[model samples]
Target: MWEALVQPFAEFGFMRRALLGCIAISVGATPVGVFLLLRRMSLTGDAMAHAILPGAAVGYLVAGLSLGAMTIGGLLAGIAVALLSGFVTRVTALREDASLAAFYLISLALGVLIVSTRGSNVDLMHVLFGTVLALNNSALILLCSIASITLLALALLFRPLVLECADPQFLRAVSRLSAVTHFTFLALVVLNLVGGFHALGTLMVVGIMIVPAAAARFWAISIGGLILAAVTIAVAASVCGLLVSYHFGLPSGPAIILAAGLAYGLSLTFGPTGSFAARVHPYRHADA
Candidate 1:
């Protein structure tokens, strides 16, 4: 069993790359995502995820699955979602949630249509479910580069962006820096999501960005603490998921998601903040 477990790592280059790629992505995505939840922007991650399809379709027709082409397309599609949703609300009376909902549905449909016209469902499934364990060396390099740039961008923006999310009005009035912070964070999200999609696929990568953060919230009551917890969960899940699937012959991407889900469940059930166990503390209630 041990040899079978370690054998894939040694023999398969793709498996090695997949392991490293998932860890890096999880590290970058967890922090950003935790705050997205804090900001009530989880749905935006969902929208950006599905929007990858149309972008990927265009890229496929033009340059096949080349990472440059796909990343460009995914980046554009993600920004377009942000801008369109922002535009609708700025111009009309609709709530941001409603505008984002409309944008996500439309982008999802358009992506499907484009894919149907030009590509196979098999390719779509590969993109949606991921080709992580099957990645070429070029895809690995591209994924690593995208992850690094995104992490670097987030490191620069972390303080201002967190401030803006938690206290947007204060930042805008006092620092005169809200616009810079907001747009820079959005751009980093674009980079992160695009990079994550390469491994986790379009729709499912949202799990990478959102689940660990959701779980981390159970243990974290502050921005910095939450981010630390989320990154911890993300990396643990990534490593465990890859090993579980590699040894057991399960698909790699979904395994990572399942591991994340387990973390989320444990946190919700037992962590300190709003945990079920925390809420129903029998000993405390007995004293009362």
Candidate 2:
């Protein structure tokens, strides 16, 4: 059993690369996800993930499997969507969510059309679902670099970001940094998503970012603890999903996401924060 468990990573370089990429993504992206959750912008994050597709599709059409091309395309697309959504929200009466939903849907349809016009369904699958186990050295380097940059940026912006999340109006009232903070956070999200798309694709990258963060919320009370819990959950899920994919020939991206979903489910029921059991049996815990 131990041999069966250990042999895959020990024998296959691709599996090792996949593991490292996913772990790097988790470490870098999950904290941003926690902030998204706190800001109640989970849906916005999902929308931005889809918005990345059209740009990536265009990149693929032009450069044909070039990571740099695809990464730049995704970043541009995601930023455009984010900026457009903010603009719409400011200019019109529609809320940010509605604006994002409309734009992202259009983005997704455009991506599909572009991909269909230029590529096969297999190529489309690759763009949407990614090829984690096939990460090259360059991809690994990109993931690790994004992780380092994200952690550093988060560390620098922690206070302002926390204030922005907790009370945006007050943050704005106190300083001009609010808008800068917001945009920087969005850029970080785009960077992480672009990095993630290399491993998990446009569709599934959001899951890697959001699911672990959601699961961790039920287990952590302080902001520091929350970030730690989210990262831990994400990394653990990545390992488990990789193992499942190796052993059973499942899709690595969705397998990793499913592992995170399972953790979310378990946390919802049993975690320390506001879990089902705690809610249902408050008196029992109080006595204990």
Candidate 3:
């Protein structure tokens, strides 16, 4: 059993690289996801994912498939959209969510238009779906670097972030770091999404971020518990997804997301925290 599970990664360099890339992404993306879920900005993560597309597409237009070009393009586009949406929310009557929705829609359309017009169908597929099995050393380094940065940023932002999520008004009243914390968090979201796009593509990378965090909610109530559970779920899903992709000749990105979806399904049904089984058989309490 161990050999069956370990053989592909041991035998194939591509499989090993893919495994490492996915693990890095899982570690970096899951914590951001937990906070996004806590702040009820799950869909915001999705929006930011799509918002990076045009910049990546433009990068492809300018430099073919160069990793550095696409990474820079996607990062710029994502940060621009995030900052723009926040600015609109502050200056205008529109809410942040609504402003974000507007910008992301425009960004998605523009990106698709650019790719479809300037690139071939094959290029479109590569941009939209990613090629996980073909990761080079540079891509691996980028993923690892992003993961490291994310961990450090989260560590620094932990207390402010928790306060921001738990009591926004109180946090604002107590500290001027509220806005700084929010935008910094958004920048991290952009950074991780850009990194994830190299492996999972824009459409599916958000799945790695959001789904595991959502599933962890079924098992953990505290912020720390949720982060730990989400990371565990994400890493396990990455491993299973890679093995299934290797054995079944399936696309790696979708396989990973689907594996995460399965975890979510099980967590929903069987987890001890507000799951269906838990609801059906409530724990009895006695008066003291």
- Model 3 TM-score, 2 decimals: 0.97
Question: How many angstroms is residue 119 displaced in model 1 relative to the true structure, after the best TM-score fit?
Answer: 1.1
Question: lDDT per model, in order?
Answer: 0.81, 0.93, 0.94
lDDT of 1 at 106: 84
Task: Give the clashing residue pairs of candidate 2, or none.
Answer: none
Using lDDT as the measure, the top candidate is: 3
Backbone Cα, N, C clashes tallied per candidate:
0, 0, 0
Clashing pairs in 3: none
* Predicted candidate 2 versus true structure: per-residue lDDT over 1-288, tens digit per residue: 887778998999999999999999999999999999999999878899999999999999999988998999999999999999999999999998899899999999999899999999988998999999999999999999999999999999999999999988999999999999999999999999999998999889999999999999899999999999999999999999999998899999999999999999999999977999778886775676
lDDT of 1 by residue, 111-184 (tens): 77877778888877766777778766777777677667767877887777878987888888888678888777
